[model samples]
Target: DDMTDPVADSARSLLDGHVVLSRKLAELGHYPAVDPLASVSRLMNSVVSKEHLLASQRFKAIYATYQGAEDMINIGALAPGANRRIDRAVSLIDRVNEFLLQPIGQRCEFQQTVKWLLDITKSWDFLLPAEQDLPPEVPAGPNEADA
Candidate 1:
């Protein structure tokens, strides 16, 4: 909402804020875990282009769907698509859990974010790959890449 405030620490204050990631990422030890629900941008409609806005909206919809599935898990219910959608959501979440949340003071590059977004936003036409396709922990970052 206040993207112009250079002093603000929250994402809404950033130039192109969209969805806040999740604090759960931090509890799980992901650095800079942003709350997707908290990361909404108030300026998208007015300041951004139609294509970008639509792309962002699509991304958010997937996150929301995944979030809904998470809620269903709590109530012991599954969404209509069953393991198919869940697998995709898992891959999406795993990528977030593995690659998206950068370390303290580090930032995700544009292409990285784009690739991640595209990979997850894909419509499921086939059964999602086995959970084995998802990483159990954070994927190696730039820091880990050298070591």
Candidate 2:
């Protein structure tokens, strides 16, 4: 299965940044002493707004590559291993979605969830393999093995 290394690298970098930012916030006690929930809300708002945009962009780029490969196959190109890459990308997107759905609050649970996400982000470099090979063109049709 051929994976797109650039897309993976981008995701890794974004997640790493998120982890670093979260740690910095925690160390600085940026969550207001007067109202921790307010601070968390503000942080979540930034996550939902700015960070999500980058996540969406990365997913879109990956999805576009998958779609392009399909288009190539429809045009009789010999591309292979696109489905595997698409599957991996979909899994990554699912993880992001799951993380986004977690409730926001000042509770230890919330903080732990954030820390868990940071850990996951930090470990993305290890999750993906280092190398993948892409064929020059799409195969004749959808490979049943991919299904």
Candidate 3:
């Protein structure tokens, strides 16, 4: 989530970095640039609930799988043996791509983010647009913006 912050954050700020999303989302091309590898969150065990934490882990795993599949595809090695996995990976990547279809200034709530993430993990086939896929919008909730 940090776009290379220079400020010497306090211990609270350091640990509060429960969610470090990859600003390199290809889905954000409605603007420019993205970095997919640097994304994962779950540091605030003291504040966030357990269920959501677990969901976050699942979300991380999915992103990891997508990255792996992308690597394979780039190398032209995603062939017969890893066929299904490759399909799932590309599908997951596309799903995340679909997620970037949001309007400007609007933010997804923590519950809504978790909901989309859970839905993302449960089924690779189900693709939702940013508007319909997301839960109801809320005030500035527990979330960080990406590129």
Candidate 4:
């Protein structure tokens, strides 16, 4: 595996981003009197929405990389329709932006949706095979063993 792979790097960066944005949004909940619309709009512009676009591209890259070959296909075998999880996470983020644009009193679970953004990060971890899932070592052939 290439240690400096850009796709993996981007995924890590996006995961870190979700952590920051979720913390900011969660902090707003502490100040009950503060209006969330402005803070959310700023977050959307600054990080959340930008990440949302990158995520779509990342999803395609990931699927193309993993959707074929037995070894590369472990992601699908492990998560089964895992690509949809990314789409769902993106949709949740979109709902947050849509909610922010609406007038007050329009019901939406802003906090819950923000929290769920972490799921996008969590879902990627599932793609990694656990130690138990690793294939067993093959026995060496007689000629190779003599060497």
C-alpha local distance difference test of each model: 0.60, 0.43, 0.55, 0.41
Model 3: lDDT equals 0.55
Q: Worst lDDT window (10 residues) for model 2?
A: 32-41
Q: 50-144 in candidate 4: lDDT tens per residue?
A: 55544433443333333233253434443433444333333344343343343446555755654444344334333444543344568999899
Clashes of each: 10, 6, 3, 0
TM-score of each: 0.50, 0.28, 0.53, 0.25
Give lDDT for model 4: 0.41
lDDT of 1 by residue, 1-147 (tens): 354565555534555656555556767886667766557667668975674566566666556657867877668786444555565665566554454467667777776676666565555333335664344666789998999
List the candidates ranked by lDDT, beginning with the highest. Answer: 1, 3, 2, 4
Extract clashing residue pairs from model 4: none
Which runs in model 2 stand beyond 4 Å of their true positions? 1-80, 83-85, 103-111, 126-147
Model 1 TM: 0.50
lDDT of 2 by residue, 1-147 (tens): 112478755765555232213343345554321221111122444566454434334544444444445456567664345445554544464454444342346354755664545543432332244344333464556675576
Error of 4 at 90 (Å): 17
Error of 3 at 125 (Å): 15
For residues 120-144, write the lDDT of model 3, one tens digit per residue.
7665432335354344566664565
Candidate 2 residue pairs in clash (backbone atoms < 3 Å)? 77-138, 78-137, 78-138, 78-139, 79-137, 79-138
TM accuracy, model 3:
0.53
